[model samples]
Target: MNAQAPHRQRKSWIIWSLVTMGLALFVGANAHLAYVAFASQPDCVSHSKGSGEAHDYRAAKSAC
Candidate 1:
């Protein structure tokens, strides 16, 4: 009925909005997952007693 048309359309819009948000979130979270946790390729060799090369500097390394 015409009286309920607006409500249906509003509900559809909300559903679409939520779907879009979820899709964006999923894509954003997975987009770079393959590059996470795994160490990056070492640029140069490191051979200190307890030294190692920087592996994808996600954070600063402290001196050991």
Candidate 2:
């Protein structure tokens, strides 16, 4: 079987290389998800109107 040893080794190397690549992709995706979960901020707008005791305030997409 010595004649086929090199071919078998090459196939094993290719499989391991693909497994490593898949692991790296999974890690990168999780890192991106964590970053977005922690680092994202809301973009919002607000408005306020007042006339003495008739004061009013409001914010878009949220309660003010």
- Model 1 lDDT tens row, 1-64: 5899999999999999999999999998886775674645555544344435554332345333
Q: What lDDT does each candidate get?
A: 0.70, 0.80
- In model 1, state the lDDT of residue 38: 61
Best by TM-score: 2
- Candidate 2 RMSD computed on C-alpha atoms after optimal superposition onto the true structure: 7.7
Model 2 TM-score is 0.64
List the candidates' TM-scores in order: 0.53, 0.64
lDDT value, candidate 2, whole model:
0.80
> Which candidate number would show the highest lDDT if scored against the true structure?
2
